[model samples]
Target: MTPIRRYATAPGVPAAVGPYVQATSAGGFVFTTGQIPAAPGQEIGTFADEVRATLTHLAAVLAEAGSGLDRIVKLNAFLGSPEQLDVYNQVYETFFTDHRPARTTVCVGLWGVALEIDCIAVTGPGGDA
Candidate 1:
């Protein structure tokens, strides 16, 4: 087994939440933490806004892990309400049209977010250089 490596964004994301690593890599797999629609302290405003912000942060974590959204093979999405599903899919499609990763979405009683998203990506063939 290859040694796992961890990365945090430059200046890193704040720790107002959990202590989990932003992304963890092992054996070419990069698993990201569930990203909420948090604007640091502000509420996760709307469905579209939440989706956009969550994906943006997820993308950055992927980059730090030597991967990108294009490499994502699986995604798990959590929603605070079922009504947001359609709009959520629309916003998700905007970022993931080409690299259509397998996904699972669920409506849950998420505390501080309208949505949360996480992914697992395989590092590209060059294998993290």
Candidate 2:
């Protein structure tokens, strides 16, 4: 089993999972865990709000791993409700302003959150062209 490198800071986004790395870098790629709107016990507002908040945390994780959202090449989005799809896309477009990574949106019976997002990005120090 190969162990991926993990990065963390003294003051950074807190992880709810006990054994989750902020970001994992392996096999020439960086994989980030699913991010939810639960920010250190902050109450989640709306689906769009959760999506935006989660993405912000993901960006921070990428930064800690020497990467950024612009470098993301793929994403997996899980939504509790299908009706929020349009709003999710709108907020996603607003944040991922540069690289529009290939994405998969899944409508599930229930997510661990109102919105959840995980990403796979190239591990490097360049923004999308």
Candidate 3:
């Protein structure tokens, strides 16, 4: 038998702009979609603000999925420009703190947003390590 896949919907987080859920879970892992800076019917903000908002959205999704930032095992980040890497890191540290999940970041064009982030985390009680 295969494990059932579950989708997550977080009311506090912005709804998905595309045809995808906020997060999905299966086999003890929760996978989240890349969250952009703009919320529903909102304007994008500064680079730092965008990064902060993206992470905040991710946190909300994780919480809704029975996971937290501390349970994140990996993260993939995209930035509008390489120059914003420093600012991104500064704001990212504030949320992640000492919990350093494996991460990969890249410079890429993001429609009208400055930053986007997606992550994978353990599903239950800090995960089954």
**Scored by CA lDDT, what does every candidate get?**
0.80, 0.78, 0.83
Backbone clashes per model, in order?
A: 0, 0, 0
What is residue 78's positional error in candidate 2, in angstroms? Answer: 0.5
- Give a tens-digit lDDT track for model 3, residues 16-65: 77788888888888899988766644776677888888888888888888
Name the regions of candidate 2 deviating beyond 4 angstroms: 1-3, 8-11, 39-42, 126-129
Q: Ten-residue segment with the worst summed lDDT in candidate 3?
A: 1-10
Native-referenced Cα lDDT, model 2: 0.78
**How much is the lDDT of residue 60 in candidate 2?**
85
TM-score of each: 0.87, 0.83, 0.89
Off by over 4 Å in 3: 127-129
CA RMSD for every model?
3.1, 2.9, 2.1
User: Higher-lDDT candidate among 1 and 3?
Assistant: 3
Q: What are the clashing pairs of model 3?
A: none
For residues 2-95, could you state the per-residue lDDT of candidate 1 as single tens digits?
A: 9998875523343336566778899989998888766455765666887888888888788878898889989999998988999999999999
In candidate 1, how many Å is residue 59 off? 0.3
TM-score of 3: 0.89
Off by over 4 Å in 1: 10-16, 39-41, 126-129
* All candidates in order of lDDT, best leading: 3, 1, 2
